[model samples]
Target: MITLDNVSKKYQTRDKGWFTAVEPTSLHINQGEIFGLMGYSGAGKSTLLRLINLLERPDTGKVLIDNQDLTAMSEAQLRQARQNIGMVFQQFNLLSNRTVAENVAFPLEIAGWDAAKIAQRVQECLEIVDLTERAQHYPAQLSGGQKQRVGIARALAPNPKVILA
Candidate 1:
């Protein structure tokens, strides 16, 4: 389960004023459920999603996943915790020079997976996103949709328990 307890975020503007990106909010999303946030642009949708994974830390309240409080975790603990959470960004953040397969293997490599295991998982993830045939293609060579698929493949390579897209 994902729980946001009165989470909020704000940014300081160049003019020395504050811009509230997310107002105080609380929500819960249970496992095995699919949820969507709908609103006009700048409605804090992306901020909320980032809060869930602590890519952007909340200024107030707590973020919990399956009863673990992400907000209170130490940096090292948070780094380990993040491996179980995956994110696919609105902009595909693939490395321009890395091939699709290499992109998918990036996280696994960071987590210290052996080469053979990384290669196997990369192939599996690529197959899941139907990008196996494009494994050798660089991000610049792919169409937008294909690049997005590569991002998805990369996010899935770790078999994350929670995926925020």
Candidate 2:
């Protein structure tokens, strides 16, 4: 489960000085539930998601995943905790240099899985996304949907419990 308690975020701009991206907001997403935040562009939707993952630290409030306060976690602890969370970006941030299989294996490698284990997990993830046949293809060689599948596979490679996409 995810909990955001009175969370707020702000950013400093060159000319604007300070811009409030998200106002004080509180939300909770229970386990096994589908949650959606809808808004027009620049409405802080992406910033809110970034705040959830600690990719952008909030200026106020707390983020708790299964009762562990993400805002208070040490950097190492945060890294480890993040392994249980997964993310897929609409932009499909695939590494152009790596093949489809390599892209899927990246998260496993980062999580310290052995080469064989990474290979196995990558295969499994690719199978889940139906991308096994495109294992050797590069990001540039794939269609938009295929690239999105690669992102999904990469997120699933670590077997995360919570996915924010």
- How much is the lDDT of residue 44 in candidate 2? 95
How many clashing pairs per prediction, in order? 0, 0
lDDT (tens digit, per residue) of candidate 2 on 1-165: 899999999888999799999999999999899999999999999899989989889999999998999999999999999999999987999999999999988888888899989988888999999999999999999999999999999988898888888
Count of clashing pairs, candidate 2: 0
lDDT string for model 1 (67-160, tens) is 9999999999999999999899999888888899999999999999999999999999988999889999899888999999998988889989
| Per-model TM values vs. the true structure | 0.96, 0.95
| Segments in model 2 whose C-alpha atoms lie over 4 Å from true places | none
Local distance difference test, per candidate?
Answer: 0.93, 0.93
Model 1, global lDDT: 0.93
State, as a TM-score between 0 and 1, how close model 1 is to the true structure. 0.96
Please report how far candidate 1 places residue 55 from its true position, in Å.
1.0
Q: Which residue runs of candidate 1 sit more than 4 Å off their true CA positions?
A: none
